[model samples]
Target: MDKVFNAITTSGEEGVFQTELCKSFSLDSRDGSRLVGNLEKQSLITREKALYNGRWTYKLVVKKSIPVDAIEQKPIDLSSVEGAPCICCPSQHLCSIEDESNPISPAKCQIIEEWVTISFNKFMMIQQTEII
Candidate 1:
């Protein structure tokens, strides 16, 4: 991290400073120009671009903001007892069954098949916690 910081701020009296990416990281163009763009195609550095002093240089592109990705979900058939009856009705049916003995009416457990997926965003926020 220190090396990265140094490379980013590697400025001399001539005012020319640059650093090749040591590792894949989120770009912080506070000062100096870090090369960007696909190096294979051509140089991505803009001499006039900067987050502060009008100079940002880098070879690899570091996208700061990231969009979230939606999660996928699939529906499945629910397991049900064909002849299970609701407490209220003697005949087998799919409904709530209330207990008469207890003042609190508890319904008979039912088979509920649900499907859900978790969505995640590829956000790169500042680290809030440090692992000691």
Candidate 2:
């Protein structure tokens, strides 16, 4: 399942065809289909019907990434919004003027307001800290 998920994620938004997945994992059609069905049921991936090499098949796309690491990590403070745009935007690939989907450019994004406010607050905090 991990290998299958990896392959689909590696393909990115383009997704991986069921036939290709079966071939790569040396899995029979039934097994591959079953695995894909399970993953889809879990909302981990979506299997969309697509044309592959003039044949009909499903393209498996990752809906979300599951963190595999077990290491304990510090929680990031939400009050500090540094690098928020890059961290939050899902349509970075379509950010250019040529892309019609980009209704708000990064320079004009309302989402960045929180980030700017947080940054200003941090800067003020540093100034106060140094003055003391």
Q: Give each model's whole-structure lDDT.
A: 0.32, 0.84
On TM-score, the candidate that comes out on top is: 2
Q: Model 2: residues >4 Å from true position, as ranges?
A: 65-132
lDDT, model 2, position 77: 82
User: For residues 1-132, what per-residue lDDT tens digits would candidate 2 score against the true structure?
Assistant: 988888888999888999999999999999999999998999989989999999999988989655768556888887555477756587766566555576856665666776788788888999999999
The Cα error of candidate 2 at residue 67, in Å, is 12
In model 1, residue pairs whose N, Cα or C atoms come closer than 3 Å (at least 3 residues apart or on different chains), thus clashing, are 33-56, 33-57, 34-56, 34-57, 34-58, 35-57, 35-58, 35-59, 36-58
Instruction: Compose the digit string of candidate 1's lDDT tens values, residues 50-92.
Output: 2423645433232222344443456565433332333344433
> Which ranges in model 1 have alpha carbons more than 4 Å from their true place?
1-35, 39-48, 51-61, 64-132
- For candidate 2, report its TM-score: 0.48
Model 1 Cα shift for residue 111 (angstroms) = 54
